[model samples]
Target: MRDVAQPAVAAPAYVVGSGRNATLSPGEIGSFLKFDPDGSGGLKPRVDVPTAQAVVDKDLSSTEAEPKDATFSFAGDAATVVPAVTGRTIDYQKTFAGLLDALGKQGDPTPPTTFTPPPVPPGGTRADPPPATGRAVNAVYTTTPPKVTTEALQAIGPATVIGEFQTTGFAADSGQNIKRVADQVNGATVKPGDTFSLNDFTGPREAAQGYVEAGIIEDGVPDRGVGGGISQFSTTLYNATYFAGLDEVEHKEHSYYISRYPAGREATVFDGVIDLKFRNDGTTPILIRTLWTPSSIKVQILGQKRYDVTSQTGNRTNPVPAGVKSLAGNPKCKPSKGVDGFTITDTRVLKDVKTGQTTSEPRTVRYNPEPQITC
Candidate 1:
């Protein structure tokens, strides 16, 4: 038989030598001169020496994938791959901690995807989470310089004109309203030496202003009046002042016994008519605070007291016996008519704040019930 012919399998080899077709060893990367774009293996001196060296060095370095210095080195046992990637020395502890924490959450539940249609609707529906249910901290801050809100008044009010409070009552306005305007006025400050007006703290009460006319029993019949039932206001104030042991400079008794006010010690008031007044009776500015409860109105006269007192008020109705002849400033008094009346007496337990001394005393005031005639 003739000699069997062997087919050749061509595996490329690199040559490193002075020849234009120099084949290189494993240490050498490519042909010495230049890459032939035409696939011919012959070297062409097209590139300059500098550019040729750069390309040659890049290939040479790339071929040695593992650095010779890294072989068999245990000195940097704790170092990481790409240690200088962050442009700073690695905090190995923190880096591992973060990595471990991430791995720990590998099984953590993903936040459920919500199909919110563009802008989400308010108020949680069945599909939504329960309106961010949690024990959240609530904080109140003034949004616009503590503005007076109609919503606040609307939400808190349309108050029952208790026989003890008026439009100037704290219930009718916000604390900011009272405190802000009071700060603007001068002689309005009620120091130990000065007397204060309720009107002073609340600014002015006027007809063409914010106040609405209310019906009040004037003389005997219910008449439309401004600041009517303000005497009830006076009563609340008196109760506070009396309790605080402040000396009252000027005050009055109502024309009739008002069930809500402190008895005899209370002062009555009517617009352009009767007025009730009091003093600070302390060394500091006395701020008046008022609060209304379900059954009663509360007034707080806050100040460093000259004395302390247990001021108590009780009501006693002295009904005009079917017919009491009226003579005090009323010509329209019905003498021969079925009528009723009452009286309220206020008692105070006085105590000296400076000395811490205490005592009980009675404040005398008289409210003449107007005769309601059912003739």
Candidate 2:
């Protein structure tokens, strides 16, 4: 009986530009491309090698002074002080909890957590393409990707041939002589936080970087004398890395495979453009120690044994042989004068040099016929 008044009317379901503009979907728009933490714009985080080494040394010294307390509750004195001990607790906690949870869920089932985020419209934050400088081209291209080769996995440190492969005919290390000095390094150990800049070590990719007008392989073709054989360092180091179990953050595949390298194992290098980089993520510090005892240069990796450094490669003989499936396209390539235009089926072998034993595994390096140029 008390005020049986009327109710207000309901609004329409669909209204165009009535209040907020209408869109097909109801979701907020943002960057369509996921931002890479390690991408160009992100902070370049680095740990200094010297600083890291100092920290480790200091830690070892302090730990030696501390007495070992085996009992979990022996004393509440230094539990909070030791970082190593602190981290160990975290590892154990996560592991045991996971194990117990798995055991508990043997028969029973639990509800899963679900999330429904609002939809995002197309084209939000646009990421600009990488710059188009020569170095930039190499930089972007090198980061494209790389395929591992079993042969490369077999050939690693100490056991590696470490040959110079002297490029003699064209001044060996010349710019005018055609052959040029593809690349050079003093073999200084790179510290943590240290960068491997090709331009810094080898100078510009010009005559100064040491090479002259000569027949150099480019895009699978010996187009003429330009930059020559410079890609070998990248390819060689890449092979060593495959066997070393080191991470390959970036690399570039050749337009066409090179016969000298395990087909999928090669990498390219261009001064100020493409550079090889890796981080020593082990808790113990590492050194990029080099030794030039003989004619060949050896790049050695030195670090404390954190985890069992493990490495693997595709079978040199191919885990899945080419005979399993025949390759298509023209098998032959046209050769140029004084240039042997021929295909070199990728053939490689891997060698592992751990403390006790050494093993060699073969791999295949294929070459699509590259037509060399003539004057």
lDDT of 2 by residue, 289-367 (tens): 2233212333444333222333333433322211211123424333443222222232233233335343443333433
Error of 1 at 334 (Å): 15
| lDDT by candidate, in order shown | 0.39, 0.32
- TM-scores for all candidates: the values are 0.42, 0.35
Question: lDDT score of model 1?
Answer: 0.39
List runs of model 1 lying over 4 Å from the truth: 1-189, 199-204, 292-297, 312-339, 342-345, 359-361
Error of 1 at 257 (Å): 0.7
Highest lDDT: give the candidate number.
Answer: 1
Write candidate 1's Cα lDDT for 1-375 as tens digits: 011111001111221111111122222212222333446864322223343234333323322122111001113212111111101121222212222122212121322222232332321111211221111101111112112222222221222211122223333332233233323321122445677665544545544544445555555644555544445555666666666666766677766655544457667654445555676554455444455432345555433435645657676555454344444455443333433555555677776656777677766555554554432
TM-score of 1: 0.42
